[model samples]
Target: MSTLNIRKITPTFGAEITGIDLNQPLTPEQEADIVSAIAEYGVCVYPNTGLTDQTHIWFSRMFGNLWTIGGQGTRLSRFDYPHLFEAGNLTPEGGISTDEMARKRRAGDRLWHTDSSFTKERTTYSLLLAHEVPAEGGETGFADMRGAYGALPQAMKDRIEHLEAEHSYLYSRSLAGFPVTEEEVENGMIARHKLVHTHPGSGRKSLYIASHALRITGMAKEEGRALIKELLDFGTQPQFTFNHYWKPGDLVIWDNFCTMHRGGEYDDIHHRRDMRRTTVMAYPPPPVVMDPRFKDRFDPAQFEAMVDA
Candidate 1:
C-alpha cells in the first residue's frame, strides 16, 4: 500500500498507477487509497498486468457489486472469463451471433457514453481489460466530466444546472441500427437523470451527459436538440479527453459516475479486437413525480409495475 506510485497524466483526466501487482491481494489501506485515486483522477491504468479471473472479480468487488450488462447474459463468452463481459468480434467456435452481428455490435460502441447510464441504478465504475487489441485502430477514448463542466460558458452552466435529461439504451443501440427489443423498452430500463450530477462521495459537480441522452426536460424539441449538440461538442474537446491505445494484459479502470467513454472503430470485418468489461452498480436516483394533472394519462401504478418488472 505504502509502496504504490501514482502519476497524473493530465490536469483533469488520467493517472498512471504503478507498483502493487494485481495478482496479489490488497490490504484495507491499499483498497482505500485506490478508491481515492480513482475519485481524484477519473481514470487509472495498470499497465503490463496479469490478473486471474478470481482476482479480477475480487478487485472489482472492492468498489461495489459488479454491474451485469442489461441485455447480455450472466456469463461471458466461452473464450473469455466468466467474470468478464466480452466486447468485439465473435469467437471462432461459437458466439451469440455471426461475424456480421459482431461487426455491427462493435461499430455501435463508437459514440461516447457512461456504461449502463440507461439503467435506473447506473453502474458506478467500469474495469476493462484488453485481451486482444487490433494492430491498427481500436483505441478507447475518455472525456473528463469535471473538465467539461468547468469549461462551459457561465450562461450555459446556469441554464443546465436545473435541467434533466432522459437516457435510453434503445437510443444508444439505434445509433448503430441495432435497437433494443420491445420488452426491454417497455421494462423501464430507460431513466431520466440530471444534466449536472453532484458526486455523492466527493461533492464535486460534473456534467452528466452522454451520447445516449435523448432529450432534456422542460425544453422544446428543437431547443433540446440544439443545446445537446452544443454541449456535446464542447464536452468532447480533445483537451478534455484521453485516448488509450491498448496492449494485451493492460487493465484500465474508470469512474463511470463522472466520465464518458467511447470505442474507436477498427477493422471489424478482418482484424480481431476483443476487450472484457465489468460494471459496478450504484444506488438508484431520487424519484421524479410527474404533474398531477397528467396522472390519468400517465398512470403511476403502470410506471411502478414497469420498473418492478
Candidate 2:
C-alpha cells in the first residue's frame, strides 16, 4: 500500500484521491484508508486507469457485499456479473433504448436520489466507473446532505428529526410514467428509513431525503411530499453540491448514507453514454462461512477463486 494524495474538490464533501491503482488487489491497510476517505468526505474519486471488469468487482467487494438490482428495466452491466448494474442507455447486445417511454424511465434518473434507497437493506456506498463518456452533459452531481442538515433551521430540524419516510421504487417509477405491475409492488420493493441518518463511522448527522422517499410515515401524503421536496431543493443548492464531469476510467465512490445524487442529461440518442456501478450494502447478513470466499462477508462471494484483502 502506498500513501494516498487527496485533493478536496468541494469545501463540504468531495475529494480526488491519487497514488493507488484499482487494477491490483488492495492491501487491508489500503482498503481501510480508502473506506476512511469516503467516511470523512461524502465522495472520493479514484482514477481507474487500465482497470478490468474483474478488477472493479474485486475492489468493490472489499467495501462490503454488493447490492444486486432486479426487476423493471434493469440492464445488467455484464451477463457474468449480476452485482454490477449498467447506468447507461446501451442494451445487453449493445444498442441504445429507442422507446421514448423507456428512455423517459431512464431519464427519471436525472431526479436527485440516493441509489437503492427503496430497498430494505441499507446501501452504504456506490462505486461508479465511467467506461465510455459523451462530449458534454452526463455529469453526475452529489449533494452534501450533512452540510444541508447543518444549515437547517433548528425548528425545522426539530420537526423532522424523528420522522421516517417510506421509500418505493414504484412511486419513483410512476413519477417518470414508467409502468409497473401491482404484483411487482407487492413483491416488497418498498422500505422505510430514517429521514435523518447518522454516519456509523463519524457519527455525524445527515438529511436522508431523496426522490424515492415517497411520503413521511403516518403523515398526509401531500403535506409529507411537500416537505420532502423542500428538503431536496435545499440540499441541492449550488453551495452544497459538486457536479462531476466524467472521464474514461474515472471511478467515483460515494457514501450513499450521507448524500444524494443524480445523473445529468446528455445526447443519449446521437452520442453513446456507458457506465457501470457497484453498490455496497451497509448492513449485510453474516456470511455463509462454509464458503471460503465469504469468510466474514454477508452474501456468498461470487468469485471464490479471488482472494479477499
Give RMSD to native, each candidate: 8.0, 3.8
Model 1, range 1-309, lDDT digits (tens) per residue? 355698888876899888888777788888888888899889999887787555665677677655433235433355433345766575734333344655555566898888877866677888988777888898989999888898888998899999998888777776677746645654645688999989765678898888778778788967996887788888899999989899988889998878889998776666777677766657432254533432232233433343355
lDDT of 2 by residue, 179-286 (tens): 766566556568899998787867999998788887899999899999999999999999999889999999999988898999998989977788888888777456
Highest TM-score: give the candidate number. 2
Task: List runs of model 1 lying over 4 Å from the truth.
Answer: 69-76, 79-82, 92-98, 179-188, 284-309
Sequence-dependent TM-score of model 2: 0.89
Backbone clash numbers for all candidates listed: 1, 0
**TM-score per candidate, chains pooled:** 0.83, 0.89
Best candidate according to lDDT: 2
The list of candidate 2 runs beyond 4 A from truth reads 69-78, 179-188, 287-301, 305-309
